[model samples]
Target: MNTTILDMVKIEVTKLLAVGIIYPISDSHWVSLVQVVPKKYGMTVMRNQHDELVPMRIQNSWQATRKDHFPLPFVDQILEKLARKSHYYFLDGFFGYMKIYIAPEDQHKTTFICPFGTFAYTHMPFDLCNTPSTFQRCMTSIFLDLL
Candidate 1:
């Protein structure tokens, strides 16, 4: 069964709510929110005051008053929070290795076992951060790559 992107979004949204990790990152200034999903994946979806979802490229630095990024620490917290449930949530991300898996002595790789194999974008969202005409052009280029 193939899950749509909307399905992914909804699942993530619900999981965040259940863990009580859903909070606006900045109450009066930065205007960002963090959603901590247990088990599967961790994503940060930004939004405006109107509650419209804004797409964001992943960043290297922590955005606010946190000692670490929300998703990383949140996973640990969620693990502790749901320790009794043997098969509780696990966290996955879009790219690179999560620091959570690194050993103190052998900190070389961040290899996570993905049942779905690698996470390459065969067809990325064309409308993301682009005008209609530009999106159409990108679509054409993508199609060319397919061939």
Candidate 2:
């Protein structure tokens, strides 16, 4: 609402755009509204190379998007599989979700509007309802040989 907050939002958006994480989208049928919160407390969010919080889009498209119901292995199942393994590999996906690319035709579904401008995600954002399954599928493919 105030000029001070508006400036901060603009700065964040500019940074994301420069990094190719988001692109200016003038028209999107699925445009979602943007709200500037002090932090990304609950949802999956990220920080740029400078460690500043990047602008994140919050869309309700998850309510309609088809879920990729890839069941995650239960802990006991995982333990059973690894019980006698000679070695184990652990990967931290702290920022891995952001590395997953979003399809060009579907990027608009993640679009959001703000005082600065309208934009859409170029990579998978973790808040999506299907993100967990999508990420799991990706990890499964990458670790298929290991498994």
Candidate 3:
């Protein structure tokens, strides 16, 4: 990482730490490698204060997580269900997955190591192998009646 990006990472780490999103850890058996990724919009200028969000990832640990084979609705099925619908209400749950908290007993499994320090997530991040299915199940459960 270059000096500019490193500084940004430190700043981001400090912010997350202060907000109780991540906590420093001395050690863990399931530490993940941290990575920096640009958001979908991508970074336009490196110096931009609003630079894309950095996705802290568990590159190798992903292989270690058990896959949640929860079935999600197929796109064709969904479109068929709404074929004649006149009204549509799209739910934008972007970042909503973050609301799913990791159980206290299992939070340690999400530990990640970075240059700044070692830490763990308090909630489910996007990179988890089962995140999609897990998040889908959670959303479906919450909106069971509506769906």
Candidate 4:
């Protein structure tokens, strides 16, 4: 399915209105995986600049084998967009680390710093600053790319 401009505007407005409100999931059979796709391409590498390993872009990152009604691109897209807008696109957290998947033909020697240590390998590209504004800029880049 294609994304619409109005849809994106609504999403942004919603997030702006709801900053710090996390909902709790209460389902015994609800499980999902959040993948982190690096903006850059290549092998995992450490980045002292960000003080952590880079993470890859989230591709098939989130998975829900069985659930009541799992949103397809919406879920991932929303989270990813939020991350990007909130400067958490790299899936950076303080719990675990992410892994890297380097393609043979890839040639981008860049790495990102997972915000919360949620990945194994480090092969994501990151810009300086790394703040919510930074994430917004990144999100804009992605939108432009899609166009």
Please name the candidate that would achieve the greatest TM-score relative to the true structure.
3
Query: Model 1 reaches what TM-score against the true structure?
Result: 0.21
Q: Write the per-residue lDDT of candidate 2 for residues 1-147, one digit (tens) a residue.
A: 578656777886898799898999889777666555455663323333333333333356544566577987788988998888988876666468879999998888887677778889998776565777889899999889977
Clash pairs detected, candidate 2: none
Candidate 2 local accuracy as lDDT? Answer: 0.72
Model 1 error, position 145 (Å): 53
Candidate achieving the largest lDDT: 2
Cα error of candidate 2 at position 32, Å: 1.2
Query: What stretches of model 3 exceed 4 Å from their correct place?
Result: 43-64
lDDT score, candidate 3, position 16: 67
* lDDT, candidates in the order shown: 0.31, 0.72, 0.69, 0.31
What are the per-residue Cα lDDT tens digits for candidate 1 across 82-127? 6656554333322211111222232111111112221111122211
RMSD of each: 20.5, 6.8, 6.1, 20.2
Error of 4 at 92 (Å): 16
lDDT for predicted candidate 1 compared with the true structure: 0.31
Better of 1 and 3 by TM-score: 3
> How does residue 30 of candidate 2 score in lDDT?
70
> How many clashes show up per model?
2, 0, 0, 27
| TM-score against truth, every candidate | 0.21, 0.66, 0.73, 0.17
In candidate 4, what residue range of length 10 has the lowest lDDT sum?
93-102
